[model samples]
Target: MARFFTLEQAQQLVPEVRRMLNEAVEARAELEESQQEIAECMRKAHQMGGVDLDTGRLVLLRKRVDELGKKLKEILDQFEELGIQVKDLNIGLVDFPTKYRGEEVLICYQLNETGVGYWHGLDEGFRGRKRIDRDFLDHHEGDLVH
Candidate 1:
């Protein structure tokens, strides 16, 4: 089942979620860099007839890529377990599902933001974010069954 979050509840998790998001973003970048380096090395080796290449460095890069992939996966799994949706890894954008006026909406957060102050409909996405105003505050709700 999809877990819903109130603005306050989502705000409370920002600190920890920000840390994890940063870690995951960094790991993803490192993973991409390592993969690119390995590809370049392979390309050079192919062009040079597979001679005079730094195989040791290539092996190390491969290992680093594997480690980074595992780390990224763990971070993503944590997000899933928390019921947070990762929108953009590069900018560390995420969404917390919530109900506004009894309709599903998203509480949006991005890296460097101080708190969760904006929201949008499921189809609106980040581009359509609107500041959480008095109307939204009064109507938005989290899980009610519990």
Candidate 2:
């Protein structure tokens, strides 16, 4: 069975989650910029008769690009482990599978500071989040396994 969290609870956790996602996205952007620089260097190298000042610089650029790629991969892996999905590179959102009662649910972070209290159904809007029921709250309080 899946466990459901109240919208308020979910909201509380959003700020922290959003911060993490933002870092990941920034790292990815850096990686992309590194890749573009490497590509441009390679193109310049190829144009210079295959042996010139630009060729040596291209080698260094390639190495830097490789390092950025590794860093970006690590960041992405971390984000995945945290149940976050990169939708808009500019905005971070949590995309984790959750459960309410016995039903599967999808919870998203709105970057609010309410802590994991807000939640919506798979097909519901943010306005649809309701206060959790007593039974559900009790189950969570007891830390019961789902």
> For residues 1-146, what per-residue lDDT tens digits would candidate 1 score against the true structure?
78999899999999999999999999999999999999999999999999958999999999999999999999999999999999999899999999998889999999889999999999998899999999999999996433
Instruction: State in Å the error of residue 11, model 1.
Output: 0.4
Say which candidate scores most in TM-score: 1
What is the C-alpha local distance difference test score of candidate 2? 0.57
Question: What's the CA RMSD of model 2 in angstroms?
Answer: 5.3
Give each prediction's root-mean-square deviation over alpha carbons. 1.3, 5.3
- Local distance difference test, per candidate? 0.94, 0.57
Worst lDDT 10-window in candidate 2:
136-145
Q: How far does residue 78 in candidate 1 sit from its true spot (Å)?
A: 0.3
Model 2 CA deviation exceeding 4 Å by range: 1-6, 52-56, 83-90, 110-146
TM-score of 2: 0.58
Candidate 1 weakest ten by summed lDDT: 137-146
lDDT per residue (tens digit) for residues 1-146 in model 2: 33343444445546666676667667767777767876776677678855644656667767777776777677667656544443344544454455666665555554433444444576764556655556544433211235
